[model samples]
Target: MTGFQNILTLYRENATTLLIVIVFIFTFSNNYICKILPLS
Candidate 1:
């Protein structure tokens, strides 16, 4: 039971990190693409 609880905690931490990485990628991509396009 203790091992299972530890695994759950680890999973939650990793999930939060993954979410942050995903958000960073999305924000970076959008900014890069916008810079490449010309605006009037």
Candidate 2:
């Protein structure tokens, strides 16, 4: 039970970190593209 709980905690922490990185990447890409595109 203890081992299972530890695994779960680690998984949750990693998942959170992954989500944050994904969001950061998405936002950064969008901003970069917008800057490169010429405005009408």
Best by TM-score: 2
**Residue 19 shift from truth in candidate 2, angstroms:** 0.1
- Candidate-wise lDDT, in order: 0.96, 0.97
* Per-residue alpha-carbon lDDT of candidate 2 for residues 1-40, written as tens digits (9 for 90 to 100): 9999999999999999999999999999999889888863
Clashes of each: 0, 0
- Tens-digit lDDT track for model 1 on 1-40? 9999999999999999999999999999999889888762
Model 2, global lDDT: 0.97
TM-score of each: 0.88, 0.90
Candidate 1 ranges beyond 4 A from true positions:
none
Model 1's alpha-carbon lDDT is: 0.96
